[model samples]
Target: MKKINEITEILGDDTSYYLDHVSKKIPKERLQIPGPESVDNFRESDRSPQVLKNLAQLYNHGNLGGTGYINILPIDQGIEHSAAFSFYKNQDYFDPENIVKLAVEAGCNGVASTFGALALHSRKYAHKIPFVVKINHNELLTYPNKYDQISYGTVKEAWNLGATAIGATIYFGSKQSNRQIQEIAEAFEEAHQLGMATILWCYTRNSEFKTDSDDYHSAADLTGQANHIGVTIKADIIKQKLPTNNFGFREVDFAKYDEEMYESLTTDHPIDLCRLQVANCYMGKIGLINSGGGSKGESDYKEAVRTAIINKRAGGSGLIMGRKAFQRPLKEGVDILESVQSVYLNDKITVA
Candidate 1:
């Protein structure tokens, strides 16, 4: 694939590590990876028929459709990062219709955003592309902002807006985590009963997650556990950040884990670390989709392609990237989203 070589050129010296085959700590053969037949796997589970139908609509649209890999555009930052700050790069996004239009033009499988974003334009665009309404957000307007996630709207509200899925975030390690978990679990239950799918932004948040030398929030072991927890809550899809390193527990001298977790089950390799994320999703019974972090200007396209390659090779699902696409001009944003979708559509790129 030409895109593979493009990734090599973009990564430069880091190319070999990103391209290496992952150790068999978690065999790709045993993983239920994304594909045209992936929707069949859900029928065997407890998901309702209507849930299955909505999932089919999600998987069978846009450029990456039927391949089972999903490319979603999440734009809920209005509340999370504030409307003015998030839309500063491109004020066009201030109008919710532009957000949905961008996803459609870019051939994305779905568009995810705040409740009001999808609700206001529901009648016009909901049927054209699957809508994933983020059910909760932590408004930055709070004085001395907190890491907590609170419901911005109800799951039924999202369903009434014609959304196919409901999304929520749980800061898995924060002090208020238990309450967030209970809230999201209850919301997901209501969503499923309402015939909507569920996706969780499984993230770790703790002051101790960082050190002067390394940030352990993206640690393989830690994020992997978050994926397990997300699946336990019956999240139909788990959205996580790509693993950057391992040894979060050992280095932080915190959390509960075993030595073999690092000794035999994992290494410092990016793909292996990501494989651990897939492994924790009950060996791929639940899909693991990585988030595209904030944009990096000229490097956004390359980084987006790089992450898609890593996620696909690691036997995980695709990406739900935002800022990378939304922060730029509309055409450039479409280019960024399509660049990542190219990786998933190319048959030449196989699972590691």
Candidate 2:
């Protein structure tokens, strides 16, 4: 409901800031959207008819208004970030049912959560909204915090729970990366066979990563490779962090690039950096859904809008927001979700 100018006014005039940086890059022309025929081609080539039907239904749902864009509500953080940390700020979400209710009320295209969170209420809400069952998680309670993710449920179990899609996280740069890749590849193969779409939470987590340097774990270069791997595994959708930098290539011995490569491959602008991530997802063949990290104080809504704008402008699919949506009062959560969806539905916000 807010115009781009109004949002920029709230963000002040730090032109280099993400909000201002992205606003200046909004495409003058309308976004070149893929039609239903393209969706059909995508589904037929990589997914089953049942999976395609389910995805189409999700695309057509809620405030998305049949735009074929994603607006997913993911709540697997309770397992990933710990329940106490995840729900303490908003105790109502401690009840799994409230989590489902929030997504349904917000008119999200789909909801992604842990097995127990979605399975317990499958009979009541699964039919109402597409359920993206997160089959793997890395609990934060482990000592020393190993950078790895493990599966918690089988794809068959996910199918039985009426899952429209299945999601898993891969700590792409860790020592356990190979094993995680092999395990998830097998899981995704079975999920596609069972007529369930696959989503990969492709993130970079290297213990040896130099945090002080530009080539950190979350750099676009590393996360972009993570997305490429997700697509190689035949994941129908790739979920990644919105890239902030593109220096990961410098961290490893096998890869090297000059300063000019950054200008040629990426830009200082936030949306341009994010586009490099989308470009890695088979150039949009595999949809790119960005993770909505943690909330940022009173600017949560403003941040959400800014992220949505950047993702859309970067030619990514949509947002799979978690904490920023559920860690607030129900009304506020719904408002945030709707605001993000508006960025996709509004024609004024277009991809370059």
Candidate 3:
């Protein structure tokens, strides 16, 4: 694998520009963790040793091959977005077995999917790789696309199916936010009691959200607050979207944050925007994994690589790529996933 510095140079101009600026500011030790030797310090917490061991197993697997980072394959989109919409391009994934096969073939650290997808083949593949059962999902099939995540299964069911972790989504800005938070918090508490780690998809979705607005749902400020909530709920890992802009101050009147504070703290670079998001995850005590939004034609691979670089450089836990990998052929998907792993494995890329 090429060094991260060299890899940045080969990327297109846009990627190289951000890398050039951010690379200089990265600390000598980019990947940080708790406990001795980068192992997560969950031993001191209420989590059992088995839970810590399972979490360590996930971080230690995959091409990155260590405990300081992660590269998970989340395939729950089949239920979130309709199956036809998610797997239309790659018909092979229509089979639930193929989804597990893809994660195994690609050597992902873990695979996150719905209860049915993982449970149906749990006897065969659950022991082969770390399984993350998505306990809840929001389907778009409903009229006007309701923003609520109904429980698909119980945490105990996931543990019985040999899941190493349990994941759930919470629409932060929606009317059901309070209820979702309460439900997920209780679920995560139960998951911990069962010796399973927890992952929260801390996403913001509301009808009032405007895509063109600077402080929209995906902005750094709001998403950072979402991460804070995830950590408060005791999520072992927090999955969030990459922050595109800083629109957080507009939503509330509690603090008087000016343009100068935003620029100085987050800067204008995309990587810095992501860095701010990580900063909100209990100051990086909890793992922060960014989502791989959607595919962008021929630029999908390049964009994935760029996202990985930014996430890694900004002190993120890793990437939980879904649609970008599964939408393509298995071989192509594996290649893209490997490229993402390469970014984290490259030792020369420094970020403290």
lDDT accuracy of residue 103 in candidate 1: 95
Those runs of model 1 whose alpha carbons end farther than 4 Å from true positions after fitting are 1-16
Error of 3 at 161 (Å): 0.3
Residue 117 of model 2 has an lDDT of: 89
**Quick one: RMSD of model 3?**
2.7
Model 2 ranges off by over 4 Å:
1-38, 41-44, 251-253, 256-260
lDDT of 2 by residue, 102-187 (tens): 98999998899999989999999888998999999996778987667878989999999899989999988788899999999999
Q: Which portions of model 3 show Cα errors greater than 4 Å?
A: 1-6, 22-36, 211-215, 251-264
Model 1 Cα shift for residue 261 (angstroms): 1.7
TM-score of each: 0.96, 0.91, 0.92
lDDT of 3 by residue, 1-352 (tens): 4466556655856754655554223332443442223445464688888888888777777666564778889888778888988888998887889888989888898999989999999999888899999999996788977879999888899999999999999999889999999999999999988889999999988755554534467878788888998999999999999887775656543335676666556666777787778877866778889988898768887788888877877888889998899898888899888888777777665453
Candidates, ranked, TM-score: 1, 3, 2
Candidate 1: the clashing residue pairs are none
Clashes of each: 0, 0, 3
Which 10 residues in a row give candidate 3 its minimum summed lDDT?
A: 23-32
RMSD of each: 1.6, 3.0, 2.7
